[model samples]
Target: MRNRSHIHQLFEALAPKTEQKEKMLQNILVQSRNEKIRHRGFAPVKRLRSAVLAAVLMAGLTTTAFAAAYMGLDEAFLKFLNPVNHEQAQYLSNGAYVVDKQVTNENGTLTIKQVIGDSNLTYILMDFSAPEGTVLDAARYRFLDNDITTRQNFQSVGFKALDDGNRSDNKISLVMSVMTRNSIAGQKVHLRLKDLQAADPLPGIFETIIPGTWETEFKLDFKDYSTLYPVNQNITMYGYEAVLKSISVSPISITLKVDSSYLEEINEAAGELKEIGDNKHLDNFPITINYADGTSETTAIFSGLYLSEHISEQILMIKTFENVINDKEIASIVFFDKEIPIQTGR
Candidate 1:
């Protein structure tokens, strides 16, 4: 983890207003709650906003596993997800790593379909088989940490397989991440879900409410894990220069950090920055990661933006993956038609 003081210094330099500075500080604290520190004096709305943004950012961090581009079902279990893109939604129906542990209640049978992870994160694929015509519109889940015997924060995403008419169905697929930067090997994790709401048949009515709780426990053995710091390289996009700062890859997650030089000019203007999106500089950049195995996956940028007076200093983009990729095995990165080879900083 980076030094909080260093982060605070960067915040102090860029934030012009006292309120903005306070809000930024609150966001940092909210995202880094795993750190043992007490925060004081924050408006309730601001706190709630920061917490929601943290979940969103964390969820975005897991898009490398589940995204619009790599959504599909039925595959040869261990086959790399998109084979061509080899990016998101890799473990669709393959049961190579199936735990077979599940819970069945009135809602449905919540079965653990697949599991993958490392110290930094845990990615889970669950299959929900309900009565026919069932529509699981939304859900919530968490892992019970026994060492602490408490709950921890995580990021998640889900896809409900629609019918031929594009209508909802009983079988739904979900992928979730427990964003703990520590190894969960040989540890029993208690998982739970509640307050599931289903889509209503009537057009303008509320969703069909399902009131019940589903719980189960499972674990993963970390057979392999590795990390690499790629040589900082230069690239151009949207008529502006940027730097590919670093890359972190694992079975559960992969992360890419990009810094844009052009954004610095905009930030230096001392203008108001409603949020990272206000700049609209790094939006819709088709960023893809290529592994040594000749496979690549498109990544989603973390929604919560890192603010900076200098574009190069600002953590412009953070992309994460749920599919396993060895960082040391990374071959190249494809961004905006530019193929940047990963140079092991030897």
Candidate 2:
């Protein structure tokens, strides 16, 4: 077995490099990471939000994998996601695993396109369509129980439509993401959507759009492209002691776990954050990712700020990048005022 060394190993594999291999990765990274860091902040134990991840690639970083566009993930980002950028597309193209699993019923069809994620955040993109004659109504038709099943006590996070996939009347694209305390890198997830339906004329009811259920399962193999780094260091938060546990970065999103064990005062502040949805209390400490160049990206403009779950040792914070990123481009991660350097694994 390869040795797992601290102050180092996190940079291991994730695109292992020789002089030539490093050149290939540099070709990819040189073309990425100009966009902002991400949105979404520390939230309640496991509250799900229906949000879209809008990021893509540039012209130079295109690879054969991207050319293939195996399961439309490329298309999904280009057309479906709101705004596209040059971050992470190349890295994702080489990493995002493809499923292409499809299940059809009389009413419509469902196809599992692709997935890219780790333990904290896992995103699965899928396509759904109504049958020939009719079209799908977003307000009307939906999977009554479109959910991911995880054996490792993972929390089920809700999903939302990435966009009008295919831009067809009968079709819509969906992205389902979930959260967990454990490392789910290399874990298989069973995705099952049961009872497709539309809202009934009655206010609180539903009618069947598709008679049967649609289910597909796949494994997340993102560990090779995205690596989780353990910090195990303590930091001063609000003049209190808190542990900066671990951080894992991927092309699509960033997840960091900060541990403030058994702090009721922190919980009180978290309650206010959940209620107002802003960065006021306990937002003093900032996170920034430095690149190979002198410039760096900070957590300024986020998608959402959720301060939550101080009771548990976990502060579930997950965010996505505007572009794809690589470990080679990152020099160090700055949390609070402490700096954790990332070795190039050369």
Across residues 1-346, which tens digit of lDDT does each residue of candidate 1 receive? 2333443343333225788869987987776673323344556755776688779878876873443223323232233222222222332222123455789997677777665554445545666677667654433222222122124343333322222222256565555544542345456677777645544442333343555677877755333243555747776655667676665554435455567756755344434433444223333544677877777766543322233436235443334432334455567767664676775321
Q: Model 2: residues >4 Å from true position, as ranges?
A: 1-74, 77-88, 137-142, 164-168, 195-212, 221-224, 274-286, 300-312, 321-328, 344-346
Worst 10-residue stretch by lDDT in candidate 1? 141-150
Top lDDT prediction, candidate number: 2
* Local accuracy of candidate 2 as per-residue lDDT tens digits, 1-346: 1222320222222223588778987875654332112223523311222111112333333564543443224456433232222233344445566777888877678888877665566667787877776766544445678667776664656455654534448787777666555556677778778876666332536677667788767777554445678898987655566787887765555667788874555555434322123322333335788988777887654532233475476665665544444556778888775788876532
Q: List the residue pairs that clash in candidate 1.
A: 77-94, 81-90, 146-149, 254-321, 264-311
The global Cα lDDT (0 to 1) of model 2 is 0.58
Q: Which model scores highest in TM-score?
A: 2
lDDT of all predictions, in order shown? Answer: 0.49, 0.58
Candidate 2: count the clashes.
Answer: 7
